[model samples]
Target: MNPEDWIAHDPDPVTAAELAALDPGERAARFARPLTFGTAGLRGPVRGGPDSMNLAVVVRATWAVSRVLTERGLGGSTVVVGRDARHGSAQFAVAAAEVFAAQGFSVISWEHPVPTPVVAFAVRRTGAAAGVQITASHNPRTDNGYKVYFDGGLQIVSPTDREIEAAITTAPPADEIRRRPVHPDDDTLVDAYVARAATVRRGRHGHPRVALTAMHGVGGELALRALQAAGFDDVHTVASQFAPDPDFPTVAFPNPEEPGAADALLRLADEIGADIAIALDPDADRCAVGIPAAGGWRMLSGDETGWLLGDYILSTLDGADAATSVVASSVVSSQLLATIAADYGARHVVTLTGFKWLARADAELTGCSLVYAYEEAIGHCVDPAAVRDKDGISAAVLACDLVAHVAAQGISITDALDRLALRHGVHTTAALSRRVADPGEAAAMMDRLRSNPPAELAGFPVTATADGDAVFLTGGDQQTTVRVVVRPSGTEPKVKCYTEVGQAVGADLDDARRRAAAIELQLLASAQTW
Candidate 1:
């Protein structure tokens, strides 16, 4: 180990030593590429280089953030940090806190593991300049992440992410990044958030009973606490996977949207004869609901759940001046929300595909009260007053409340959705993904799609084509979108392509399902080239 290697190679002492210790192949794998930070923040496989999120990289990131905050007049501002049950999460959280405290900034670290949303809420609720959460979200166990949220209580946006990346690039070295020991804040931010969520919207009648699953994450306690506070006592918490375990022992993947993901919770719902099973992702930022339908438990897609929530909220407006305005992402199923908004004389706005944008907009906007906002990825923001970001706890309670209302009418969420579709026409959403090994390959795929744009897809004219990552299409009164959103996932080897298609509703359920299936095939055909 030559000292000159530190000067010629990596400047960071910790990273340099770690790299030197590794063999040739190992070092090449670790230093394959630099960490790419974007709207999602810096995330990578837990490995050996500055590119990956090792201990040294984590320290560098925190120190860089400390420098940025200080330069931005938020130098002495306090920060609240939290983590989920992902591997190395607690250690990362502690490292961040120590770095911030060493920089003379007050730190309030979580006493125990908590959800990502809770950390976002604490950041804003406590008037901190920024917050960090250590979790890989729904990614595979081999992955982990560092997600940053701003004062506005949303994930750090574009330019901000770039600036933070620059800060990290300019840091002296990993070991030089000052870090001081700090203890967790005695304060209870999640408790206060739970208390506030309880008051989202009191039903004049009664709250619905619900079966809840944390997907082996950290939302069970908060969900239970909020449900009880909201006057719903019949909430049944799933016994298995209820406790927070970073390993996620039960499920292959911790996402609620994945196939067979909610099987355990569905079984529990059947056992309890519960009307619905509510499942949240590991970070508690995304949610899914399953209702007892035909012979088995049927789970609703993210768009379906958002539409149900939107319809319920909009229906309650009662054509008053205080009509609810629904907000959804540009890529989400806008047909349902648009129809409801038009019929009820409410407003609807479309933003980029991220809850951070939705939550920040909800917090900043004043004229219209945001009743509902959701993305097709299962991220939802119900009440900005209680939480500027997504809240699975609030979504759980809202799910119960909506289920109770529909059950009173002797129908399930599926039936209600059918009715809505029959009245305003049905719409279906779908996605197509192309995975590649390297970021360069992902970029090349996008370039290929851009160079050879499809004029028509599934016999429908391409409405618009985005050369960058996504493509959009529409046909007749009914519209279908085939987006080729290409990006190297923050925590995985594969790049993702999100595609969607929609069709008008008919009198029969089978017909609607058939039409949706055909449209899905067409969308898939078009995505083949992309």
Candidate 2:
């Protein structure tokens, strides 16, 4: 569509003015292609045009979602709509709720910002036909998104996402779409979610001194409430970051996985002599942990936290039927969770690199339940039964419980990790992400790597290769095994390569760790070339 046509259809005068101000070339670029909807839903910059996340695009997307659900015999069914504290989030969420209500669906809308997982949890609790959350998660402040979840609380997968996109293509113009004002629901659901989240904690040890940061997202108040409900009274929060601020002035990026993102939390932890530190990303769906190291303090890598939490959760499941309980992780994550699950007599499965896939792990195995699921990007689904998505709030509560439990056992989190290493070998993991100018470049890089597979990386010969949306290479000698996964990121314009090296612990655990770290660095160096 041309700029004139887009402006005519745009519901918001601001975006329409933005379209009017753009030059012909810039306008053409903005309308060159519509935003592609996938399993993760629509994500883009908050600007004018069909390709951006303006009010018009949101209305059309909601109309399409309503159509898809209606076609599945869910026309008047309940739908939960929520938003985060990002720019344009409130408007988009309201627009979405109106569209759903106009389509004859019962809409449960929130007046205030809520975490992404809270929306997911509400879908299951209310038996809603679907849920939509207007959030870009940890993305930059300029970006926004629309996330969709199906009846079971799991994110919409392959065919469903494709169907929604197709429906979106057939949607009417924004001005033509019907709308109905929706009254915001009460906080009963929020209270219910907090209660359910608190239940994830096992027998409580004395409250450990915990430090937390919300990373300027919407998780702070609810996270604190959940922890307090679980009997964690010694929790301290970074006041500067506890409030939801869309600008994210404190960090270069809103994501907790980025360097220096958790610096303030760590500083507070050190000042208070905290036993554990937690950082939740902008939307509070992903979590990063900080701990005391040989130096002042260091944030645990996603894999390290994954291993610790996985071990703790499995350890507490003393009498679960081994064959009926399952734990899952993304293919790109470290395989240490598999070892931990096996030790506890539970089954482990690997899915594609997203909670959407991990959430459905239990469905593939007959009579099995997903006890835990995590990805290496600091995303953890500690209570899949309650919320079938990565939930930083519940994960934080459980992490605190893990700290208290370990303290009661007369050991540190580091000691628990070392014990796991001794039993399962020193498994080290690292990732290399290379940014490109555009998505095409990222795809081209993946294609090039796939077409010309390297024979070896970091002195380890490539013994096997598996090809799909990503490429997997396995190689090593008898003393060690190396695995590398290279793929284009689903949400960003970059190609990511994940490497893991496993070595059996010898009499000197330090020596084993040193050897593994060296190999991991070499592998990362090699991956940089690709």
Candidate 3:
């Protein structure tokens, strides 16, 4: 990745010129190597370097995808390319389509901004060879990404990701790749997605007041369509964030899980006295929910929402055969979902993090059905058959449906959660993330934790501690007290700690939550000191 070599091969003049202008130190640092592509695909600052995500990088990545497709006997097959409303997303998406077409593959381009899950849906519905979404999810405005999905509508996995990276190593210059832009009528795919999303609705209440925000991304319009189609007519979107704006004007960050990100949506819900509130990330693959609390509204954590939705879905299958139900959650997520599934005579499966692992849980657990899979990061796969990925739109519909159903019975979501606490244990989860200037700092922090494994946390004896890429620590019995998982973020330059604590339903929920927060802060505080 020498500067001159990259300059010679790069097709985009802007990036080439940028590389040419950089000093030796800058050039070496920027072009020392290509950005690594893991389960999350390629992501970095949207600039003009081999380490950046620009037109040249897109072309090379698309070329790699094309080669892998061809090697797998999918030479002339179609690839679905979608994008969000980021700065270079549309251009990158079209460039990807051209590269696919040039490689003798058919191109299915969105031709406009769409959510990441739309790419997954289009791939599954069209039987395309693969799908590429030009987005960065909830990353900063200066950043962008390329997320790849495969034939079965799952993100590209281990051996395949490595293969694509290998092809990228020797990709031809961008100009040498063929280019024929093919645009399908966008209305067809959109209509199909809307229809499929509406099918997840199972409610007895009509038009319960709802409030929503897209966090200045592409999910607003599509989510509106799906919600209205699913009989939620009284939906009110936060006006300021309804349109797509790459700068994310209203909040410090666009992710709903962040502190101030969902403030505008909750404010609107309060102003309108809406029954429920919804927040979708920049690209809308994940969802976060809010419900009416004691005095105002409180946004539910990802695990709380995931458990509520999983329980709701399972309750609908009250009189089914043994093949009726299967639900899943990530290993780091709360185990209450498993308890609920078992109570309902359903099977529960736990997989590694990411929807790519959770999406195809049905294959891993045969016989039972695949009803739901969720993670603690606001990701839920409610309708796994339709979109084999975490789908914010469908999850929102299910959330609203749950609200309306409960409202029909004179109970709010708060009451339902209380009942769940009484039925199952009061399981609460918290997360702590420490940002560092360099990723190496994350490794160092994890090393420190592994070296001095805590025998106890928050006055509770540690029952177990395991280490690999991360350090997993448990305090007291797993059913009570705490579970701590300290790991580097799959993406981004940060180390994250996830903690879930529980107190038996007859005990105090506040006590469990306070102790969990204390332990989480203690771990993160220790990391800061290190």
lDDT: which candidate is best? 2
Better candidate number, 1 or 3, judged by TM-score: 3
lDDT of 3 by residue, 199-265 (tens): 8998757678999999999999989999989989899999999999999989887889989888889
Q: Model 2: how far is 381 from its true place, Å?
A: 0.7
User: Per-residue lDDT for 141 in model 2?
Assistant: 90
Tell me the spans in candidate 3 whose CA falls farther than 4 Å from its real position. Answer: 319-324, 477-479, 507-530
Candidate 1 RMSD to the correct structure: 3.2
The total number of steric clashes, by the backbone 3 Å criterion, in model 1 comes to 4
Global local distance difference test of model 2: 0.90
How far does residue 480 in candidate 2 sit from its true spot (Å)? Answer: 0.9
**What's the C-alpha lDDT at position 514 in model 3?**
61
Better of 2 and 3 by TM-score: 2
Q: Model 2 over residues 1-530: C-alpha lDDT tens digits?
A: 45687699888999999989989999998888788864367888999998889999999989999999989999999999999999999999999999999999999989999999999999989899999999999878999999999957889987888888898878988988999999999999999999999999987687898899999999999999999999998899999999999999999999988888889999999999999999999888888989987777998889998999888888877655665789999999999899889888899999988888999988878888999999999999999988999999999999999988988999988899899999999999998899888878987888888789889877888854655678898888988989999988777777889999999887999999999999999989888887
Off by over 4 Å in 1: 1-18, 204-207, 318-326, 332-335, 362-366, 476-491, 506-509
For model 3 the local lDDT of residue 506 reads: 42
Model 1 TM-score, 2 decimals = 0.90
Q: Write the per-residue lDDT of candidate 1 for residues 447-515, one digit (tens) a residue.
A: 776667666766666655563344444443343333334344444566555555555555576686687
Tell me the TM-score of each prediction against the true structure: 0.90, 0.98, 0.96
